[model samples]
Target: MDPILLGAIFITPIAAIIIIGLIWYQKWNYTFKDLQHIKGPTPLPIVGNMSELGDPTKIFWQLFNWQIQYGNIVKGCYGMDMLLLISEPEYLEFICTSQSTLPKGIFYRYLHKWLSFGLLTSKGKKWHQRRKMITPAYHFKILEQFVEVFEKNGNILVEKLRGEVGNPSFDVNIYLTLCALDSINETAMGTSVDAQNNSNTDYIRAIKEMNRIVVDRTIQPHKHFDFLYQFTNDYKIEQKCLKILHSYTLSIIESRRQELLNNPSRFDSKYVDEFGMKKRIAFLDLLLQSTIDGKPLSNEDIREEVDTFMFEGHDTVSTCMSFWMYLISKHPEVEAKLLAEQREIFGDDPKRPTTYLDLQKMHYMEMTVKETLRLYPSVPFMMRDTLEDFTFRDLSVKKGTQILMLPFYLHRRADLYPEPEKFIPERFTAENMSKRHPFAYLAFSAGYRNCIGQKFAMIELKSTLSKVLRSFNICSAVPEHNLVIKSEIILAAGNGYKIQLKNRTW
Candidate 1:
């Protein structure tokens, strides 16, 4: 054979393998390449814009920088795939409200190891079914029943703070986290972790450790694959934490089921109605009996969902409350308004715990919470997988592309919110809210996939704030500009919110 023909034959097969691998790897990028005209920070060939991903803070900082440079809809890349950061409300409304775009994206996978295919992680038919099944758990009456639990926890939190009233400024994140944890335990599981009193409990420790590890996993692209994650020290620690968490929850679930079974009368008609036989108040009770299209959930399936609720219900609320407290501390005028509202609702007795109805009467305090959420949304952003090609104004989004909706940026839009950086509770009022685009303020997100626990969260916020303000006034040691925030799945302060508490004399 000729030398040239032999060389061509050998090179052709090797070239074919290389070409095949590249096509397979860059399939998503190629599919969305039509969007190349959309301006963003230039991405490298294979790794894309995943550089500096090891630091969670810098990862988000890059996104923010790109948003500033490129505009609301900034195009970026994740590995070999295309990503679009959508912040404008006009586009937000289209993506969030659409059922086709409801499926979660890559970052959510970091949570799935611990949470499994739960409501937050699941998609397609399974997600739709679980959503319907779980919807009733947050019913008005059910949540109203949870208010007493909220009030009880709020009282416990106030009592806890009473000791720290005159002490140096302390980070209240852990304190508030424990209170929220206790409330969720009692309300969601009908069990007491006693998080406030038993702060060193294994369950509490496990949850904290697990969250930290998850944050570590999310930022590092190399750790995203299961095989790579398994070799790390964090993975071993995560496994131990998961074991403690799962065991504790399983033990609690078993205990609760046995309690109901052993004593028939204890199963109140309010909780377990005759026809369908569903529980009333506790979220776990509903989960225990819940069926999707006449099929009941398995033990593993139930665990996934219960675990997800446990994580979301407590952690996010604590973060929100911490920031809420910090914001009130900085703005004494806002604090006075909040106190005035609390006084009007509670009257002569400042010690009275807020009822669900009391929460309803706390219109001003509610607005303050809304404004706080806008300033520091609990979940800064959400990821969605686009189901099909779509256009928002002039911009075109391709199918299978991941959409990063930055509620943090959207909430801070100067056009949408005047003096956007300022803490303005009045902005959430009916008149002011009516003027803004409905999707512009997405503290709890919006539309079909909005946070189901939003109302439950508000009740907890109002209940806790009412009690805290009634007992003590907030004073921040950390200056407004000095408080540094970083996005680690949820919005978190680098150094926790440090605020001194003064005993309120009503």
Candidate 2:
């Protein structure tokens, strides 16, 4: 073979590829021109600032440090994509409350595998319709129905924790999460998953694995494409996990739908008892009977919403409750006040069931829970992708850019809340709270896209935490072990949420 002939074969294609690559790079790199006003670490080609973002476990704090250096509104790159992180109150207000920014970020595509285009990921008219339809399910009136479920599951948690009481320090979050799973299953589907009693189950394991794979895919750029991701091991695990989660949800939905068909009036015609309480109905029941465009929602659509909430409902409350427990253990003064409040609510019997009205009456515990959420919001960040150009001061945010609202960083801004680092529950007092910007604290997020079941979560947290405080005196392990924060899809303690419990004596 002649050298000229060999060069013609290999060099011709190589030259064409390089020419195409250069053209692609120029077009791709040109999009960040509008974001030039925002400050961030310099990005490398392809990988962008991800190399500097460091380990996934520390990405939460790495981004925080970047914010501290770059100012409130910061931008970073993952490949050619741009991500904006804002801690400024006005900016947060603009993005969260405004209709223009309602659609979730591009990464939510990952959740489509499990959550689908449910309320958590849906957009435009569909999002509006689903949200409007689902809103009634979470009304304070309906949330009251689940108070007994919370009380029962919370009580089970207390009874189960009896073994841990007066014992060595242990990861209380594991128990609390199982208890929360039980509560969500019972309240959301009108059935018991019995997660509290049997911690090791296929469904439970699938839930954990699915959350991990979702977060993993969201951050890694190459996995963003289904063409590439479908070939990976995580994708295989994701499908298996989805099978378990969806099959369980579908089975429950079918059973509940048949029950609804048998006695349609059972869901309607509210019958108030002598105690003035209506029958407890699960979130699943409401969806089964709900209509979209005046037609019944399909099983998949119903499953999307039901599974969305069920997935959203559990670990969030459990993580919040677990962190609250850890916070109280560290601050005996705060715990003392919480214990006093519990005594006032339950009086002499610490192991009493909490009515919805009773939960509403506990003020300090609610404040403490809010404070816990401030420090460690279950979803540390909420993201939005601009469908239309968005403006903040001189910055022109082009369409397709992602806006990351990190409450973990925003809630810590000194200007927003003076002494922001302190865990002072009093800051949430009505008078003190009035001094702060409304968007300054976004634990449950804000405005139209905010969490629909926030009130439901609040009631659950109050009911569960109050029960724990009433039954046991909790303390962090001796010498106060610190938690390594993992701020992924769910904010969690990389180190276990460890605590010791002593039986309560009043």
Candidate 3:
């Protein structure tokens, strides 16, 4: 036998064997078995049900339809990836409440890179530690201290809107985003970013870019390949955005440190009334003062928490406000009712902004906000990865499988919410709430990892809505406009929310 011929024969079989092993590994790692009994639309290879997700406008509706067809608990695959969609309240309770078994999925790893093990993305022991450290910042008493911040920012928002009332309708999303940014910065960071006045600040710009990039990554399948993302334009944008965000945060941290170092007496008892009383003891301050196991947090830890709060605090609340404003604009009856409630609560005091006490008294307003969140949660979907092989009911779910919970579908389930499409706030009344499952309304999510800023968000929403309603009457400029929702990091309207605002007679 020739030497060349023998070498070729040996190489060919080795190459063939390698190829076969690669194929088997791909199938073993990515593909799911026994999903036939679980029920869902047939998934295409590699892409899975991702093809159905391309159109943002129809994605949520289509997912809901799938839930209807496949029942409350549906199992599907996304490109060789196994995913379980749980819309049932009982199952959701199990998943959310069971902290030890399921952790945030791989999708959250992208967020973890930016947020760095903050409460939102951290899991198990790390999450437990961070959650405890941060819990004090969101205490009811601490939240009470921030009421003035909400009202002041809310008033500023109203003034800004009042200026726009005479002009043709403008996109309310921008204004809502600004109001949220301003509110969160003042209340959470104890500083004013003036987002409404200086909307193009480096921090604000970076945040918008970060949001855009994250959403883009979630939608683009090719970006999932680590090497591809590293070389892609999207990745470049993400890197630049992260740099801008971190730089801005570091500057703030350094400034605070210098201010404290230069005036150590600022912490003294005599200076308590002069400096301490007047000083802003905001969320960031609390985090700065917090310690664990006899050691204070490092700059890196503080940065992570601050950045996490900055992103989560503003975006979710803004998204909620955007949806709530659009809904109010579309439904004149609801708006009118809200206005009437505001008038009744304020009683001819148009200049007086709603206080925390006054806002708490606005039961109807709270219900409306709750209803809006139910209909259009900022986070439409949440993903969890199974830590171990688990069984729910009769189905066996394997480890590493992604569990997707669509709040968009859960909130609209006919079984859970009757007349699901209708904007009925009465359903949230104490009486009606008692009749419904607690997990059915998950706008801020549920269980231990539920939104820590829920109360703060509600306070901001109420104050802004009340003040705005007092000053101006909002109506949709294009009442028949079929506003499509863009499923990004936040649920934004595709074409923006254009609404007409008329200054009130009062």
Scored by CA lDDT, what does every candidate get? 0.83, 0.85, 0.78
lDDT of 1 at 475: 90
lDDT of 2: 0.85
What TM-scores do the predictions have? 0.92, 0.94, 0.91
Predicted structure 3, TM vs. truth: 0.91
lDDT (Cα, 0-100) at 97 in candidate 2: 80
Candidate 1 lDDT by residue in tens digits, 140-193: 888888888888888888888888888877888888989999998888788898
How do the candidates rank by lDDT, highest first? 2, 1, 3
For candidate 1, list the clashing residue pairs, or say none: 271-280
Highest TM-score: give the candidate number: 2
Residue 184 accuracy (lDDT) in model 2? 92
Please identify model 3 stretches exceeding 4 Å from their true place: 1-35, 54-62, 261-277
Give model 3 RMSD, 1 decimal.
3.4
Q: Which is the winner by TM-score between candidate 1 and candidate 2?
A: 2
Q: Rank the candidates by TM-score, best first.
A: 2, 1, 3
